[model samples]
Target: MIKCNNVQEQAQDLCGEIFERWRELLQSGEFILGDQVLAFESWMSDRCGGAHAVALNSGTDALFLALRALDIGPGDEVITCANTFVATVGAIVAVGARPILADVGDDELLSVETIAPLVTDRTKAVIPVYLRGRPLDIDPIIDLCRSRGVAVIEDCAQAIGTMIDGRQVGTRADASAFSMHPLKTLGGLGDGGMLVTRDPGIAEYARIARNHGLENRNESIRFGINSRLDSLQAAALNIKAQYLDQWLKRRVEIAAFYDDVLSTTRTGTDLGRGKPGNAYYHYVVQSTHRDELQAYLAENDVQAAIHYPVPIHWQKAWLSSQPRIALPTTERLSRQMITLPCHHHLSDGDVEKVVTLIKQFERAVRW
Candidate 1:
């Protein structure tokens, strides 16, 4: 059976370099905020077009730190898509802020139009997630936020290398958080994340905050959390970073084939949001019979999944805390979308098989 990603095979291809770096990292004994982490951060910041990059233990912490840097707490309101991963909403709650939902469009992107009404005087930041690796056409959103003096902290957990208008997406926002949770386009061997910002002050604050507010070896500048990114994982990422572009290219190729075959149906873009640079984190399609289609794929030995089966607004966790938020688009899209395995490890023939299975399921449903 063709797996979603043959991670072991992909890693084995680079184990020689990773183990060599590992041996060096062990010798240095600067495990925490050491040379490996600094090297990865330097290379990463350059790639992200950020003035600084703050590496952390997880993407959840990255978002939380970004929020903390902006001083979003207590009654401050944060606007984000209702269809995004729970981490996006959880981060706001983690920082003691309220998470307001914005509906998404057919593109699975939350736009300025959808978010405009939700903004208010208490709006501290808007975390527009680049869902499914396609960066939102966020110029309008940024312009609106800037007019009101609201911060735009883009949730770029999915789109590390995505570009819009010849520049990287992370560079477009005041700050953006990226995940390397072994599943992202630039995945690490384990959980890892980074926060990038153009502002030196925010960068400095986040950097210090990630290390328990340490000003010096033993001095505490403020109350902070321990969320530093591991050097070992950084070493692994350094090895994998070399092949990110190559792997992304393969993912794009697979996405193109899926797009052509699934075009007649309700499918998300393979290349993503009218750009060749999206990370293609997930190749998703909208199927009214989503549950049936998923089961069919399973029977056929194809592992299809869902980005989210339910919108965050409707989740028991959110609805219980807050009143029902009206988000028809988010709710509908959640039920309709089905994620197919389009990882770099799959061959062209594997992709063809996935498409064929879905087409067969659709035909069976029609009959």
Candidate 2:
């Protein structure tokens, strides 16, 4: 079967380099919060337009830390998109803040217009999730938040290389949290994340906070968590980081091919016509027969999946309060979005084969 992502295949190319880094790490023997971690942090900061990047154990922790660093806690409302991964809202809840929901635009980004209505005196921050590797049009949201004295934390888990007007998405917010999960475009060996911020205060606080809020080895400056990005993961990530641009290029090429084909067939809708430099992490398409299309693709050995099938407020966790908010677009799109294979490992032939199978399905429907 043609799988959605072949991380193993991609990792094969970097095996030697990673091993070398690992060996060097072992020789240096700085395992916990070592030089490698600092190196990776520096690399990411430089790459993401000079933002101060603090490496952490997971993107979830990064989000929690970013919120915590900002002193956003109970009674504070953090606004985010209704159609985002649970982590976006979960992060808000993680920091003991109320999560206010907002609808999305046709591009599936948190509608800047929809968010303004959700803003109130309680709104402390706006966490705009950069879904499917497309940076949200964040300037308007930034303007709105600044006027209201609200912070912005960009959920950039799927948006490492994504650019908006030549600047990376992570650098566009007050703070941005990125997950380097095994499935993300910039996948690490295991769970890893980074928080980027232009604010030096936020950056310093995150750096101190991620290490259990310790100023020195024994001095506990504040309450924090142990969320360090390990030396080994840093080494592996540095190896992968070298080839990220090329990988993103291949992913873009594959997405364009699928977009061109799907446009003609009209079997699916690409709602992620995001900002110009989107990284196309999971080439998503919306369709009425999303479930059917997914099943048909699986049957044909073309692995297709959905980014998310359930809206946040509709999840079982929220069934108690049952948020009585109008999110018609988010509710409708949740059941209609399907993600296709847009990994770097797939070749031109693989892309063509997948498109051929999709077109075949559309043709079959006509008959």
lDDT of 2: 0.86
Q: Residues 197-312, candidate 2: write the lDDT tens digits.
A: 99999998989988888999999889888999988998899888988999899988887887777887766546776347889888888777778778989998889878788888
Q: How would you encode candidate 1's per-residue C-alpha lDDT over 178-268 as one tens digit per residue?
A: 9988878788889999998889898899899998899999999998999999999999998898888888788888888887878875443
Q: Rate the local accuracy (lDDT) of all candidates.
A: 0.84, 0.86
Model 2 misplaced regions, further than 4 Å? 321-326
Could you tell me every candidate's TM-score relative to the true structure?
0.95, 0.96
Model 1 whole-model lDDT (C-alpha atoms): 0.84
Worst 10 residues of 2 by lDDT: 266-275
